[model samples]
Target: MDITSPSFKENATRAIGDKSLQKALGNVERGFIYKRAKAVAAVPAFETLRDAARDIKNHTLAHLDLYLEAYADKVAATGGHVHFAETAADARDIVLDICRRVEAKTVTKGKSMITEEIALNDHLEKNGITTVETDLGEYIIQLRGEHPSHIIAPAVHLNKEQIEADFRRVHDKLPPERNLDEPVALLGEARAVLRERFLAADVGITGANFLVAETGTSIIVTNEGNGDLTQILPRVHIVVASIEKVVPTLEDASAILRVLARSATGQEMSVYTTLSTGAKRSGDPDGPDEYHVVLLDNGRSAMLGTPFEDMLRCIRCGACMNHCPVYQVVGGHAYGWVYPGPMGSVLTPTLIGVDKAGHLPNASTFCGRCESVCPMRIPLPKMMRHWRENAFARHLTPPSERSGLGVWKFLARRPALYALATGIAVRAMALLKPKGGRFRTLPFASGWTRHRDLPAPEGRTFQAMWKDRKAGK
Candidate 1:
C-alpha cells in the first residue's frame, strides 16, 4: 500500500463526510468495546494476564536473536525451511521463489497482515501467480481491490449490503436472484466459492500469531476455520511473520494466548487455534508436503532498543483501535497503511520514516484508552509522544506548528506573562461569545471549527478562579 499517512488530515476529512463509512465505523464501538469489557470482567485475572503477556514479549525481544536462532534450528530439524528476510522486497522474493520452485499456479492466503505490509498479493499477481484470500473479510476487500480497513476485521468499513453488491459483482456465475441480504447468506456463498479454490491452490500463505521456538510451531488464532484449510489443504504452506512473533516456549505462547482472544474478539478462545509444525509426516493423512517460514525484519530490528520497541510486542489483537476515539471516527484507511489506530500511529512512523508518517502520531486524542486495553500493555500514547517529539526535533513538523509551539514555550517560561495573556484572552472570548455560547468560527482556528463548534471560554481564567476559591469568595 502507498504511504498516504502524509495526507492523513485530508483522508480523515473525507472519511468524516462518508456516510457509509461512518455507518460502518459504528460497529467498532458497538461490537468490540462492550464485548471486550464483559469478557475481561468475567476473567478476574485478565489484568495479570496482560502483565504476563507484556513480560513474555519483553523477555523474548530482549533475547530475540537467541530465540529466533533456536526457532530456525527447530524448524529445520522438523524438515521445514526458514527464510530470513531483512526487507519487504526480500520477503516477497523469498515467497515468489518458493512458489516458482513448486510451479504454483494458485495460492490461498489466510488473514496475514505481514503479506499486506509487503504488498505480497500485488507482487505475486504481477508475477503470474493467482492469489486468493480465504478469510471472509479479506476476500471481500480483495474483491473491491482495497486493503484492510481494520486488522482483525478487514471489511469492517463495509456493511452486508455493500458486500452483497460486491459478491454480486464478482461472483457473476452464481444465481442472480440468490439472497445475500443477510451476512449468513454471504458466508455460505463465500464458503462455496472458496472451497474449490482451497483444493486447487498449490500454495497456502498464513500469518502466525505466535511462532513457538520450543516446537517450531506457527500458531494462528481465528474464529473461522479458513486458516486451517489455507495451511492444510495446499501442497505447500508458507508462514510469513515478523521476527518479533517468536516466543521461547509453548508455555509462553499459551500465556499470551489467554489475553489475545479476550482482547481481540472478547472470546475465551478463538474457534480455531491451529498450530502447524512442519510438512506431512510419514503416516500423516492430510498436511502440506512442504512448510516454509519467511521471517521478516523490515526495520523492526532498528526498533529493538528504541522507545518504539514496545510496539513490536503487539499481537495484532487490535483492542487499541477498537477503543480509540480518533480511530472510531476516522477509521483505519485514513491512517493509510496496513496497520491502523494507535498501534499504527506509533509503528507507521517507525517503519516508514517519521518524515512521511509524522501526521499519524498526532492523530490521537491522547485518551489513553488504547494503553489501558492493550493486551501487551504497550504504552501507545507514550510512544506516540515520542514520535511527535522525534518529528519536531527533526523539523518534520510544519513551520506554523513549530512557530506556535515556540511562542507557547516563550509564554510558558514566564508565569506572570502567561497568566496575564490567558486572563485577557479568556475575558475577550467571553465578551465575544456567540448566542449559543460556542464559536462556530474562530480566527486562526478554522481547522478546529471546520467540523464542530468550539465552546467559548468562561469569563474567569484558572488563576482568578483559584484565587477566589482560596479566599473563600
Candidate 2:
C-alpha cells in the first residue's frame, strides 16, 4: 500500500474531531484496555512468561536465516511444499500458481494480517479466483468493501446497527422482514452462510502464527473454529507467512503463544489453537490433499543487521496500539497503511521509504507506554526518534518544519542569544496576554493563539531564580 505521510495530519485532525468515530473508538479503547488488564491480572505468571516469550523471539530473530532453512527442510520432509518469496509480488505469484495447478475456483481464508499486507484477496480475484474470508470480522469488512480498521477486531469501527444493515444488504437469501438486531442472531446468520462456503471451497489459505522447524507445523490461533474448517475441509491448504514466524519447536511456539493472546485480545488462550503438520496422512478423514507453505521475505531479511532487527521479533499482539495515545486519537486508517500505531510508525518508513512515511515518526506524543507494554520489548519511541532524526538529516521533513527547527537549533546552541530571545518573547507574551489570561488572536504566534492561549511566564526564568537564591545565601 502507498502511504502519504502528510495526509496523516489532516486525517488525524478529522478523525479526532469526528463524533461517530470517537464513539466507536471509545468503546474499543475501553474494551481492549480493561479486558487485557483483567486477563493479565488473572494470569499471575504472565509477566515472567512475557520475558520468556521475548527471549524466544530474540533468539529466533538472531538466527532467522538458519531457522528458515531448517523449517523449509522439515516441511519438505513431511511431504509439504515450501516456496520462498523475496517480495510481495513473488509471494502472490507463487500462491496464484498453486491455485491454478490445483484448479481452484473458490478459496476460504482465515484472517491473516500477512494476507492483507500482500493484498492476496485482490490478487486472487484479479486472476478469476473467488476468495472468501471465513473470519467474521474479515467477512464483514469484505462485504463493506473496506480494509480492516483494527488488527484483531477488523470490523471494530462498525456499531451493531451498521452491522445489521450490512448483513441485510449482503445476505441475498435473507427475508426482507428478518429481524437481526441481536449479536447472536447476526452471528448465526453469518455462520450459516459461511458453513456452506467452507464445504464448497476448493482451497484454504491462512497466515501462520508460527512455523515450527522441528515438526514442519504451521500454527494458527482463533476464537472461532472457522480457521479449523477453512484449513481442513478444502482440497488444498496454503500457508502464507513471513520468514520471522519460524521457531525451533512446538515448545518455542507455545512460549510465544502464551504471551500472544494476553497481549492481543486478553484471553488466556484462543478458543481454538490448531497446528497443521502437513497434508492429511494416509486414511485421514479431513485436511487437504496438498499443503503449501509460502515463506515471504518481503524486506524483512533486509532489516536484519540494521538497528531495525529488533522489530522482527514482533508477534503482532498489538498491545502497543492499545496503549498508544496517537493511535487512540486517529485509529489505524489514519496511518494510511495496513499496519498502524507505534509498530507501524517504526516499520512503515523502513518498508516503504523514510521520505514517504516521515510524518509517522513525528506524530507521536512519546509517552513510552508502547515500549513498556511491548511483549518483544521493542524500544518503539526510541526507534521513532531515530527515524525522525534520519528524516531531519535527509531533509525529508517539510521545508517549513526544517526551517523552524534550524532556527530553534541555532538559538539552542547559544545561551546568551537564547536568553535574550526568551526575555523578549516573555515580555511580548505579557503584552499580548488578554483578559482571563487568554487570547483569541495574537501576532506571530497566531497559530498557537488562534485556538488556544500561550500562557504567560511566571516572572523570572528558572536560571535567573536559582542565581538570585545563591546570591542571597
RMSD values for the candidates in order, in angstroms, are: 1.5, 1.9
Winning candidate number (TM-score): 1
Which parts of model 2 have CA positions greater than 4 angstroms off? 1-6, 438-452, 466-473
Q: Can you write out model 2's per-residue Cα lDDT over 1-473, one digit (the tens) per residue?
A: 45545588887888888877777778766778887888889988887998898888888888887888888998999999999999999999999999999899999999999988888999999999999998999999899888877787887777788888899988977798988879999999999999999999999999988899888899999998888999999999999999999988889998888888888888889899999988999999877999999999889999898888889888888889888888887878888778888998998898778887788998788999999888778989989999999998997877877788889999999989988887777767677677777557766557667657656665456666787899994
- Candidate 2 vs. true structure, TM-score: 0.95
The list of candidate 1 runs beyond 4 A from truth reads 467-473
lDDT of each: 0.94, 0.87
TM-score for each prediction? 0.97, 0.95
lDDT of 1 by residue, 1-473 (tens): 67798899999999999999999998887689989999999998888989999999999999999999999999999999999999999999999999999999999999999999999999999999999999999999999999999999999999889999999999999889888888899999999999999999999999999999999999999988999999999999999999999999989999999999899888989899898998999999999999999999999999989888989999999999999999998999999898899999998887888888899999988989999999999999999999999999999988988998999999999999999999999999999999999999998778779879989998889888999999999
Whole-model lDDT, model 1:
0.94
* Top candidate (lDDT): 1
Candidate 2: deviation at residue 47, Å?
Answer: 2.9
